[model samples]
Target: MEISSQIPWSTIAAVISWYSSNIGVLLLNKYLLTNYGFAYPVFLTLCHMTACSVLSYIAVSVMDVVPFQSIQSRTQLVKICGLSVVFCFSVVCGNISLKYIPVSFNQAIGATTPFFTAVFAYLVSRKREAWITYGTLVPVVAGVIIATGGEPSFHLFGFLICVSATAARAFKSVLQGILLSSEGEKLNSMNLLMYMAPIAMVVLLPAAILMEDKVIWITIEIARNDIRVVWLLLFSSSLAFFVNLTNFLVTKHTSPLTLQVLGNAKGAVAVGVSILVFKNPVSVVGMMGYGLTVIGVILYTETKKRYRL
Candidate 1:
């Protein structure tokens, strides 16, 4: 297909929406992380999933869109559930990392997700990557190490969690791509969000209830007192649904590598917002790492001549 023909307006709109939502999510997530604790993850996830599910249900009902249906098979249901579990864990770890690290650093480090995704795609799907893609990882990795000042003493556990989260995110993208491609249909973000939100909510609800010190009733009471929390919850929920949906649309429109590159840009945007809006601290080393990461990403993009599934 021609380049213009390949570009889907819906995908473009989804990506723009994703970026806008990321800004809101980063701001709200930073507040929750700095002020509250990991509990914010559970709360944010539940709120967003619930809101998206409700909205999706309304849209489907009003518009007479695709009806709620079972997965094509039991195996598919199992895979979706498994992927959702991994997604939940990844997001939780990512949220936890924000407490110990600057948003920019987190985004910069997380940029490695594209590299990891490319590698994982190669290994898992037997897809071949351009030789330059491997070379591009060197600077990306170097930048992350330098950006963190090679510090061994600063929130080692948090850093590790973030790294693991990035890896899991990369894996999730690859798995999502495989599943979506196998299905062989262009699914709108709202449709996919409708299915995944309720399922993920079901999976996460039990754990949030059991592990969270605050019960549902108590949490609701607290939310009543802290109206900002309620607003944040709503914003976060909308953002989650939009972001994931845009990501899927982008993957369908462009190549996985392209989507990964865009993801890195999203991270950088988050970093910028964290510093400017939240007054988060940054180091000279972190700045250098950020610069190098941009350079590496540019190199990868230039060298990449083809976009494949």
Candidate 2:
């Protein structure tokens, strides 16, 4: 069967959007927190959630990007809140990890997301894939391990937090699938962001304030000193909203496992981009590891197509 016949243009568009926005946000977050001396991951993440809330609201309510979806039941509302909580945690942890690690190494750690996603899919939803399909993940993960060995700036604390963030991300994907599996509970990507973004802000605000001292004042001070910082924040926040939107769209059109598979390829691309943008040193071993990941992703895609899994 032809690939185009199997996959809709909208799904491909969503995937492309996801790749661009995700990479852009990660790079910006790294630059802001580490090189740019912003140094407040939690507060920065709060800004992203705030942008998501406001932009998502305008997109849904005023622009009519998708039909407005009200919380149907107490149960659905609870599920959305739970998702928001996880989303907030994952994003903040991801930002914090970037403060201590290079984006390339960060992507190396993030490559493990497929493993966590596959495990969570089984445990949370009892979903299973063919053994052959599972085999494809080995190279995807092994490549990351090889890349990690090549990283010069590996921090144990950063590595741990990145792993935690990756696991949280995988769990969120599986949880979203389980919580919104019902026909009535299912929401379009835009509408889902409309509800999730604000709730995530509510969940994140207290933690941001408590963990980061004088963040508001510091942000203001930074903005006053350099208007460029303000522009960067706005640009990063806008990218963050698109990141969430495209993520939901991809997960909606495809299974969580496929999303994770795509993410492996994405990690390889991120590593390449980081090298170019930041001029981070990558050993020959790292490049070889990335090559393996690319091969694994292609094999995974072919396996899915051949077996129609």
Candidate 3:
């Protein structure tokens, strides 16, 4: 399918917007976690959730981006709660992964998300893709394996959490597609976020309090000592809010597969930026690995498009 012929300019704009926020948040959060010494992943995630909640409220109840709709059915409420669990799990794990690993390595692991997504999708829906499409995923998996050998900083625990994070993210997307596609319970991104943000916030609070509240107090003192920390954090939170906006916009305009493909491409961009900004060393082998992953991503996009998988 020739996407250009069918997708409206509005959709293209949304894709660009999502890309910007996704990339921006990755870089910003990494800076905060690694360089700036703001080591509160769960709490930081809560901040993002809180900001998204506030912004979503303003967008809906105040601005009327999409009319506020309440969840009336117990069934729908159950579904959203289930999604919230996965969503919160994925996001927290992601933040935790980034905290312990280099941004490039973190994103390299993340590039494998589509494979997990495909697996979860097939398992959940029992819908099969063409064998060729399945074949295309091999390169994606291979690339991640190759990259692992060359990772400059590989923490085993961090890598494990990141893997779980990737899987959870895939699960969330698959569930979102299944649960939200129903017309009767359908919600635009803002409305979806409005409900989801609160649930995620609730789910994350105990974790934040238990795991981070004590350790995070140190960061509070540090922030007080250096006011720039506060400014940077607030900036990060603001960007985090916009990320939800762009995330919904892209999914509204495109398929989860498209978003997955774009996310893979964004990983390459993120790794390049992280290396330049952080002055991190990338060996020849590592460069080759990164290149392989990106090539696989490109191939996957083409195969998915041509086969309409």
Question: What TM-score does candidate 1 reach?
Answer: 0.80
What is the TM-score of each predicted model, taking all chains together?
A: 0.80, 0.87, 0.88
Candidate 3 global lDDT: 0.82
Report the error of model 3 at residue 309, Å.
8.1
Clashing pairs in 3: none
Regions more than 4 Å wrong, model 1: 1-16, 36-39, 59-70, 150-154, 183-189, 215-218, 245-263, 306-309
Clashes per model (N, Cα, C within 3 A): 1, 0, 0
RMSD of 2: 3.6
RMSDs, each prediction? Answer: 4.5, 3.6, 3.4
Q: Evaluated with TM-score, which candidate comes out highest?
A: 3
lDDT of each: 0.71, 0.85, 0.82
Candidate 2 segments whose C-alpha is farther than 4 A from its true place: 1-19, 246-265, 304-309
Model 1 C-alpha lDDT per residue in residues 168-286, reported as the tens digit of each score = 99898788778666653324456666666678788778877877656577667777877666676677777766666556556666786677578767877777777798676676767
**Consecutive 10-residue window with the lowest summed lDDT within model 2:** 300-309
Score residue 259 of candidate 2 by CA lDDT.
82
